[model samples]
Target: MRLAAALISCVLCVTGTVGGAWLSRPASVDYGSLLSKASDIYAVTDERGDATRLYVVNNASNAAISRIPGAAAELPWKVNVTYSLDGPNVEANEISGASGLVGIYIDVKPQSSAANHTIPVVTFTVPTQVTGDISADNTASVATQGSDIVVAAAGNVSSGLKFSCYMDAKK
Candidate 1:
């Protein structure tokens, strides 16, 4: 009985130690490799020129997530997403009768070759049907200020909802 009890304890100890290490394993994302895949990757902006559509990498494998609508050919650079109530999710957040306004700050750029340049703040009412990673359809500005291009479009409501600036490698 003593030997059996000791054996069980030893087995449990070994199992837990190995299991803990396995559970805590972390991995690195190689964004460079994904970017080099010869696909048309773009970072879109909103009207007035705010970068509402900041990049949202998949937490699963650091993969870039994009939802192309059926009419994507008409506007290839646009980002469209489908909200899922029963969609595949790694997890979900629960709300307990919460009511208030909220805001999100997104850091984005005009072109993929361009570095991250602007910060756009998006605020919306709570309990709204906004979901699926990032901002959606609206208008933005990638125009000019005086001579130089005006990259930051602040206080633009349409710009607050959609992305205008984009990258097109389809040439």
Candidate 2:
């Protein structure tokens, strides 16, 4: 009789725990386009002090369905943007050289999220432009807490003129 009672208790405990987790998530997450929010949004600026925001634009709701299997350590997000500058007064060479005025880059890892929210797991200057010499394709990564996995990414661009920055994460 005691064995049966304990088995029943274990099943109920598991069900309750799973149910509670499902309920804790924001309701909008159920029907909205946002798949998930791995960490709070962050703002990154350039040498000229123009600021652009960063966040995971799209994330997997579950590990089995993740588009970024390599980023399994933390939810993966897309940093998509385009920046441009053209003016009659400005020199063509100057515009072409500094075309990618704003950069947004991130390697979604667990530590960069809720666990060590006080500090950035990694930090470095944003690449000023996409040039053969500068190598805007530079990358970085962080280790996952539970696995041997690492998350990595290269810089992404956003437009500018005299260095202005903006982010569109409402979607």
Candidate 3:
């Protein structure tokens, strides 16, 4: 009887220690940031100019969070998005061609009952132009299916510009 009681107590101690360690792990998101609230959609724009507009959609809820007006002052080039097992992060390339690249970071707000803060699920860069011409118009779109991120943008000197991208999950 005495041996059995001692073994039981030892097992309980080990189980409690393991459970506490798992619960004490750090969260992936920063609770104090703007992304602490829920966000259904988002957009990206250039603060310098209004030349390009990048639109993002959270298809599950169908919300739009970010936007860029036109090609007058803003010129967006490339937008890259990545979603991993850890979380999601979006990067916007604000510069075009060989000039350089500017990165924009996005954070999603957490759910009301979530244990941690909001997480970042996308990352990309915006494209830039060489001539800095404000005459052309451009539009871009981004979407995610599972772990992949897609972006598409199109533009024309005569009519205008339009681009769209969509990424599907891997098998």
Q: How high is the CA lDDT of each candidate model?
A: 0.28, 0.28, 0.27
RMSD of each: 25.0, 23.2, 25.0
Q: What digit string (tens of lDDT, one per residue) describes model 3 on residues 1-171?
A: 111111100121111221121114446965444434434324443577654743333253655344354454322222233322213333333222323222222222222322122212222322222222111112333433234333323222222222222222121
lDDT of 2 at 99: 44
* Collision count for each candidate, in order: 9, 4, 58
Cα shift from native, residue 23, model 3 (Å): 44
| Pairwise lDDT winner, candidates 2 and 3 | 2
Q: Model 1 — TM-score against the truth?
A: 0.16
Pairs clashing within candidate 2: 82-159, 83-158, 83-159, 84-159
- In Å, residue 13's CA in model 2 sits off its true spot by 47
Name the regions of candidate 2 deviating beyond 4 angstroms.
1-68, 75-80, 87-171
Global local distance difference test of model 3? 0.27
Candidate 3's error at 110, in angstroms? 44
Given candidate 1, what's the lDDT at residue 153?
Answer: 24
Model 2 lDDT per residue over 1-171, tens place? 111111100111111221121113335535233424343333455668777744443433432322344446452222222343432233334444454333333232222223222212222222312321222222332222222222222222211101122222110
Q: Write model 1 residue lDDT over 41-67, tens digit each, in one string.
A: 445666577666545333434455576
